[model samples]
Target: MTEGVPATAGSTRSTSEKTAIFWLLAGVLIPLMNIVGRYRVRGLENVPEAGPFVVAPNHYSNVDPIVIGIGLWKSGRMPRYFAKASLFRIPIVGAILRKAEQIPVERSGNPRDGAGPLRQAQQIAAAGHAVVIYPEGSLTRDPDGWPMRGKYGAVRTALDAGIPLIPAASWGAHLIMPQSTNRLSLFPRKSVDIVFGEPVDLSEFANRPRDSRVLAEATLKLMTAITALVEGLRNEAAPTQRWNPTEHGQTEIGRFNDKR
Candidate 1:
């Protein structure tokens, strides 16, 4: 809500487009999720009303994306995600991604596809839109659902675009579907909560080259913001040190057993 901090236009998906997607998707998902659990959203006003902004959230469960997407959709911002290129190759889903113009990220080091999504994110933001990114890249490995370490994509895109970055936190999503599994459980309806925090002040870091030093500092600050929000939601303090997958020899993108 600060001056010169947020955007001045709706997401690239015009109001009608957002509505169409919202109702179209919600009509099916709302009732399905409601049957599974209730949703409680807070601090939506903290979301930027205009321009290109980044929504950075901690990842914990598969359903959380749907929950977050609904929250953002309700706030008039359609989200573009940094989905894996493989998912974009699926049949029906791939068709949707192509039509929506979502960004595809290549996790492998093919050199040819390096940093493709990050650069695309900057261009998307520059054109006046919003993107939702999981700074952790994937679900948390913290058995207790706390946010682990963050990647640089979200913060880098914000800094590169000179746009406000909002840190979002969600709790009770892991309950919708257990960790490391996609099996849906609707027997017990749970409460899914999502909150959006104030934009991280990175004006000082703007215009700086994307060096290791700058990305590291910005990544820490961004994670700190997101962790604080999750801490508030959980009403408990997070560990002083973030859990690092590489250091622990765990996978970053999927199940720990995943060697990739």
Candidate 2:
């Protein structure tokens, strides 16, 4: 565990695991995010006063995590990401992530073999920290940019750890670093917004057997909350039906254009 700065006055609980590395990274990235875009946030009060909670945001650009982290920093909680293990293998970036105590997620291999990451996520929340997760696992391929079907890991971690699930959504980050390529556009600043919705009520799923049906229901609830926030940011209604990438034959791992 790493510790950095205390939580804001609104939080009864101070952030204990925010490390100096976290602060350094935030000090650099938050301004960078602002340099590339306007950082507009809302509903920070919706974040629990003190405890472990999950920040489930839709993935759209490579910059999403950085933007989300900036928002959480303003809200008084240091944000931790469930980054892919391969990313932790990078020389400098990996070392920084390790120092910051980010959790590494294994996205490949057998489904049953993925328990270690989820277990680690549970442990983090159980320790009173927030983990930023992209519920769709990667950037959305939903033609119109609405949240797509999500994996159940976020809900599972929250339920198992008895923490609240905070649905976060972002829109303008995609414009800063477009989803179609590994490129950056910083000349004309974009407007990026990340909103945190009220904790999703998973009371019904509490203490119940985590069957597939229950997990599916819980996943949809998170997606719904995130979609609502996204719509509010984008000022457009989400498609009534959530997009399923596999059904639509879009690759879940790489760049996918809606018009493609």
Candidate 3:
């Protein structure tokens, strides 16, 4: 395997343990990312230098995963995403994702079927890997770009694995590729700000039954932390109430509107 960037101070893994495909992708993508956007990363010290942890971030754009991936990479931890299973069926992309060991998430209406990915993610976290899960599940439907209601996967995974759950926020990626549009603006060189917040305190929920009420409360606490981080980056206050797709009769996944 090719030697990658030096591991962060407390990380147990060495640079040489990175997969060849990961390095290859990083070699190409990192430079491209720099050219596309100026990154401003902060609060990396909040990340546990070593151990399995789940980082949940607010999602608002199609390019979020790429930007957040780079941010975590700079923080000295290789990010393993819970990517949509559909992407794992693509030609070359799927092959690379598999080789990179990214987890695949299958979206389904059946609760049993949907639990599979979370179980796999918990196992991965237990084995001491950094897992990045977007608690929102999909891009935010909030009109002002604030985070909407979040799902329970991130909290469940962290609580089950008994690992710290870190809340993260990324701002300005939507300027590169605005929501509801396929166009890209590489000229102005937007500054993408990413901030990692301290691990959410789940002690109150620890050892409690993972019932719907408990999970919902824990998920809200996690999302609240993420929104606060985002508020700091934007220098604006989020709405008192989070946006809910169900209340608005909008689909949870995919593009709901074409307003760019």
Candidate 4:
């Protein structure tokens, strides 16, 4: 873990063994997914050996975060996700997620529960944990399935926390598990690929406030880098299917655009 950040607010849980078990499961799961789908990763060397860093990846499917999280776990880092608070209500599932130390992001548009996701991420990074952020705040729905506009939370976190930002991209997950449904399919033999780019530095804003546009600009550039990575992985290939946003519980904009 990196130094200089404070401890988590109320985490009394022990993550050491859980992390170990998670890695063990991810090891088999990731490789199995790869072998079954014939996927491979390129640019795994881009992640730091140790970190107080943020991982920004393009989001296209619900499985995107799990894939990226497992990938990072296999690479020797504990991935802490900043997920919506609503997910914390599911019975046994919520308990597991809580023990995993995933940060809860209250999306009621309230700013009173301490810092927003960005601020929470900064605190986590400052404490030496690796954070994953989807700048778009949700999944993509482009006819071609490219990354869409991203929110400013990621930029704010990276700037305020003063950590390296790594751009990551994932391909074929949308097909493996469609964003519109909760079921996995076995039809397509496509391989999922995750590409991590070299860290983007923003040392110039080390001491800046969490509200600067510079943070948003930095996030935009990071998003662009992730998009480029995804584009490369796709090799200009077309999506196997065009999912309807309504089927996935998304709004006019949120349902169709690339999230995270």
- Model 1 has an lDDT value of 0.79
lDDT of 3: 0.82
lDDT of 2 at 97: 85
Model 1: how large is the Cα RMSD against the reference?
2.8
lDDT of 2 by residue, 1-260 (tens): 00121222232366455578877887787777778888888988887667677889988888788888888888888877888788899999999988876888766645775588888777766667788778898888886678999988888887777667889888888888887777878879888888988788888788689998999998998899999999999898989899888787676763455544
Q: Least lDDT summed over 10 consecutive residues: which range in candidate 4?
A: 1-10
Residue 138 alpha-carbon offset, candidate 3, angstroms: 0.4
Candidate 2, lDDT over the whole model: 0.79
Query: What is the lDDT of every predicted structure here?
Result: 0.79, 0.79, 0.82, 0.68
- Residue 227, model 1, lDDT: 96
- What TM-score fits each model? 0.90, 0.90, 0.91, 0.77
* Backbone steric clashes in candidate 2, count: 3
Ranked by TM-score, top first: 3, 2, 1, 4
Better of 2 and 4 by TM-score: 2
TM accuracy, model 1:
0.90
Worst 10 residues of 1 by lDDT: 1-10
Off by over 4 Å in 2: 1-12, 15-17, 254-260
Error of 2 at 231 (Å): 1.1
Off by over 4 Å in 3: 1-11, 258-260
For residues 102-188, what per-residue lDDT tens digits would candidate 3 score against the true structure? 898776645576587888787777666789999888888888889999989898888877778889999999999888775777887
lDDT of 1 by residue, 1-260 (tens): 42344453454444554645446666787778888887788888987666678999989888788888877866877778888789998998887776666798887745356378888888777767788989888888776778988878888787766678899998987888877678887777888888988888886677678897998898899899999999998999999889887776777754544322
Predictions: Cα RMSD each:
2.8, 4.9, 5.3, 6.3
